[model samples]
Target: MIIAKIALELTDLLVCAGVFLVGSVISFFLFHVALRRKREKLISEAEAEAEVLRKEKILQAKEKFFQLKAEHEKYIGEKNNKITQSENR
Candidate 1:
């Protein structure tokens, strides 16, 4: 009768251990899923910021190009006026 009691106790212990292991696996799986979602959100935000910066850089370059073009045209017009005055004199 003592041996039967011991055997029942052992069975209960095994069942408890199995339940604990399954719970641990489920907890780990949920934690990993939450972590992956957070990581993806951060990556998406970074990509959006990078796209805005790229657009800003392109706009700045275009403005600089227009300024330089205007200066070059003004310089050419001044040179032409000087040449015409010299020819008249």
Candidate 2:
């Protein structure tokens, strides 16, 4: 009877250990999947933000170019007027 009890207890302990191992493996896989999803989300968000900043920089550069072009045209016009006046005199 004592030997039977010992065998039963060993079987129960082995079943419990198997269940624990399986549970741990499942939980680890789930955690890894969750972390991967989070990393992908963060990367996507960062790319989107970078795109927005690139567009903004392009727009600002275009505005500055136009402003510089207008100023250069005005300067040329003034120089031409001065030359014409000097020639007339």
Q: In candidate 2, which residue ranges exceed 4 Å CA deviation?
A: none
Error of 2 at 78 (Å): 1.0
Candidate 2 TM-score, C-alpha based: 0.94
lDDT of 2 by residue, 1-89 (tens): 99999999999999999999999999999999999999999999999999999999999999999999999999999999999999999
Q: Clashing residue pairs, candidate 2?
A: none
Q: In every candidate, how many clashes are there? A: 0, 0
True-structure Cα RMSD, model 1: 1.5
Q: What is the lDDT of residue 5 in candidate 2?
A: 100
For all predicted structures, in order, the TM-scores are 0.86, 0.94
- Per-residue error for 46 in candidate 2, Å, reads 0.4
